[model samples]
Target: REVELRLEQANHARQEAAAALGAVMERRRMLEDRLRVVRGELQSTVVRPVDPAHVMRLQVIEDQSVQALKVVRTHLGTLRDRQRALRREAGDAGARLATARTRLEELRNAAEIARQEISAVAVEIAELRVRGESVAEGLRRDADASVEEALEVPRPDVDEDLESLLASHEAELRRLGPVNPLAAQEYRDLQERYDFLAAQLDDLSSSRAELRKVIAALDERIVEEFTAAFQEVARYFEEYFGVLFPGGKGRLRLVDGSDPLTSGVEVEAMPLGKKVSRLSLLSGGERSLAALAFLFSVFRARPGPFYVLDEVEAALDDANLRRFLRLVDRFRERAQLLIVTHQQQTMEVADILYGVTLERGGSSQVLSRRIRERSQPA
Candidate 1:
């Protein structure tokens, strides 16, 4: 009985190995067929093979892009520094301008007071002259004398308090402070400086407005590009979802429609024959398929040279695995796909195979095979 059991186990192992080999052979045949079709298409279009210099040109372009990005970052730093300096200067200029205006006003007030005092003094001197002329005319008329004799008449004595009054006036003049000799010239200088600062402030204001306009334009452009890309991905998601889950509905909507640049995307999926409204409500396999559909949608929207997928169909059953393979096959001609999976169906769609195994007390070993190069079954 033990010998029979051992034989059964050995047979089972052999069968599993044979199945794996058959899967690899099937993958090889599919790749061969695809290669032939691609060649025929290329010949019909008269398209030449890929140029070896293409990679070198791409590398040069990438290097140039890096240099350009560095230059832009440096220029942005310089602009920020200049903006800070201008803000400091604007504050200083404004404070200085206010002080100059206040000084100019004080000078003007002092000038006006001095002019009033001088006018009053002139009026008093004119009155005194008129009184003296009147007294001389009276003496000439009363004495009936000649012009020279009028001067000989005796005049009244001067007021005894005249010296005291003159002393009082001198004291009052001393009470008023001495004026600034350079006040007028200093006022003119302040006015010129204020005009210059005002012009500078206007220029800074205009520059700020231009910067704001540029920022607004950049924001608008970002919104436009993001919305367009989002819409494309959403459309592709819906189409791919239908293929993966027949009769299913899928959609992507922005969390904030008014601001696409900062908004979040919401994914909604419903598998066939299910009324599910939330992703958490779906089974593990259903969620996996939905996620794959969304992922491939993005891939189609922005294709790269190659993609690496690791066990993406681990939760999928045989039917769903076939659907996943179909989706991958659609991209076969456009880009290279490297799939790492344990599923026999998934492995049966590859053009190359890589296997890893561990030896008893040694290290891990990696085995590689070109599936399309195999001539016969193992």
Candidate 2:
């Protein structure tokens, strides 16, 4: 049991660590992507000119590009560090899982052996009980035969001298009031033995009952503890979901009659006061918004170093798109957001923009541009 518990705890920790690592990876990828974009943009603007007088301006651009390259290099180093941390955590989780599996197998083998031994003992006990009952029956039959024989048997007559002696003894007993002390003493002894045996049987029964109750209580406690653990995890998920779907409300509930092993999450959305049945039912724009909300909620509930969102705003209308950008803006202080989009509005809202375009011969080129100012509100 302890091994199983340790394994479960290790797995939970591993999941949380893995989530953190994923965020970090996303951040790193975004940085690399941005770097690529900046490089591409610089290349597009620095096409070789036929005029020599543009040389100074070209040198200035090259210097700026060099500086940008240095910044990307530094970001790369940070990304490498994040990647290393994630790998280390994953390795530790794998090792722990291996150890848990080994121990669980050993326990299973021991339990199987115990079960076999118990089965053998039960069979032996049943056989012994059957033999004991047969012996008891035989003894009872013999005792009945002996009682009948005693009743039918005749007593031998006393001799004349013994009869005279007996007559004298009988006259003496009459004078002593016919007291029989031996019979009374035997009755008292039998009563004492019966009482002792009855007391011992009662004690044995009570002990067995108490042990069963204790085992039952332990089983209930185990269930309660597990339920509480599950609730804690559910609570975290709920809070995250709420954040992801702002202006909307949703919750997580354990489905009735559903096995935990087979259970899955049910997303309930009350967008604009109408309950949504399936995510697919939502429009393309709504789906994009919902997906983003879900992702954000997960991130908020279990925070990571950063997040990556690829082409996340492609389907949003202008208003919804701005809302999405604003959502990203809110998380800047808590987590770095890496966004990939082709929309100009999205690019306008970016702290840094990386563009990817195909060069003349199908080679992929990257460009980076910083948003100098926010576009005027429409």
Candidate 3:
């Protein structure tokens, strides 16, 4: 019985050992999977071994870089301060230059006034010299002798006091009347002003001549352009008018044939069986058609990328509307046309349609639809 109990205990211990071994095997498998995932990640990553010497070197480099950054910041601040100082110096220089210019102008004005005064004094001196010469000539003529003898009269022995001499000079000055001291200066000023005005007048006269020539040239150019355009549009107008109203004669006449620049235009339209001297004499539809013909004639003469016509054919009848639509058809391949109208016939000929409609909530919405191509009459 003792041996059996010992054998049973041995068997239980072997079973526990087997279970532990299985658990260890499972744990090894999980570890192997985790290792494989880590190896894959390690293959993609770049790993460098960290050395104490390299770490120390990088720390030194960072310190140097911080120092260099500080130096550069200091240099930048110094440069900014220099720039501000330079700007201030430049401003001071500009102010000094302006003040110098103002002072120079004032000096120039003073010099001009001084020069004018000097000229007036010189003129007065010349007049006095001329009078002295005339008096000397008169004395020579009256004495009937040489000029030396005429002035050789000896003075009597008398005491000519300084006060008496000054009084006599003052009395002579008083007899000369109110002498204008600024007469010569005023004359110089007037002369300069007259010269300036004369120059201005000459410039004005030349400008007037140039302006007249320009006007003549412009008038000529206008006549040439107007004549050529009128002839081309008139031809197109005749062609379109015949198309709109078969067997009708239409013409555009200038009210003043002599001058196309300032002339008004008159439209004469004669329908197939009627004679109309003026546009107003035609019926409403006929008048609209005639106007469209003229407008399209102008369009033909001057081609453009697109055209906008707002209710142009609103007064046209069905027959005239067809003619107008046919006219619009001729320009479709060359340009885009935007027509605003309530006519279904007009919309039927369009390549696109845009309409505004109200939704159930009373909000407005814009809708766009492309139209199908329709066969056009040649």
TM for every model, in the order presented, reads 0.57, 0.35, 0.50
Measured by TM-score, how close is model 3 to the native structure? Answer: 0.50
Ranking 2 against 3 by lDDT, winner: 3
Best by TM-score: 1
Clashes of each: 0, 8, 0
Worst 10 residues of 2 by lDDT: 45-54
**What is the per-residue lDDT of model 3 for residues 1-378, given as tens digits with 9 covering 90 to 100?**
232233334334334433433443344344335434423432221212222232123223323433433443343344344334433433443454445446555655655655565565556556655765666688788867666764464422322343344455456545544545564454455345334433433443353344345434534654675578678878998999988988889988877889664455667899899865676787878877887777677667766666677777887889999998988887666666778789999998887888999999889999988887544311
- The candidate maximizing lDDT is 1
**After aligning candidate 1 to the native by TM-score, how far in Å is the CA of 313 from where it should be?**
1.8
Candidate 1's TM-score: 0.57
Candidate order by decreasing lDDT: 1, 3, 2
lDDT per residue, candidate 1, 107-136, as tens digits? 667557656655655565566557766767
Q: Model 1: which ten-residue window has the lowest total lDDT?
A: 41-50
Cα lDDT for residue 141, candidate 1? 83
Please report, in order, the local distance difference test score of every candidate based on alpha carbons: 0.59, 0.50, 0.58
- Candidate 1 lDDT: 0.59
> Which is superior by lDDT, 1 or 3?
1
Instruction: Write out the backbone clash pairs for model 2.
Output: 36-366, 37-366, 37-367, 37-368, 38-367, 38-368, 40-366, 41-367
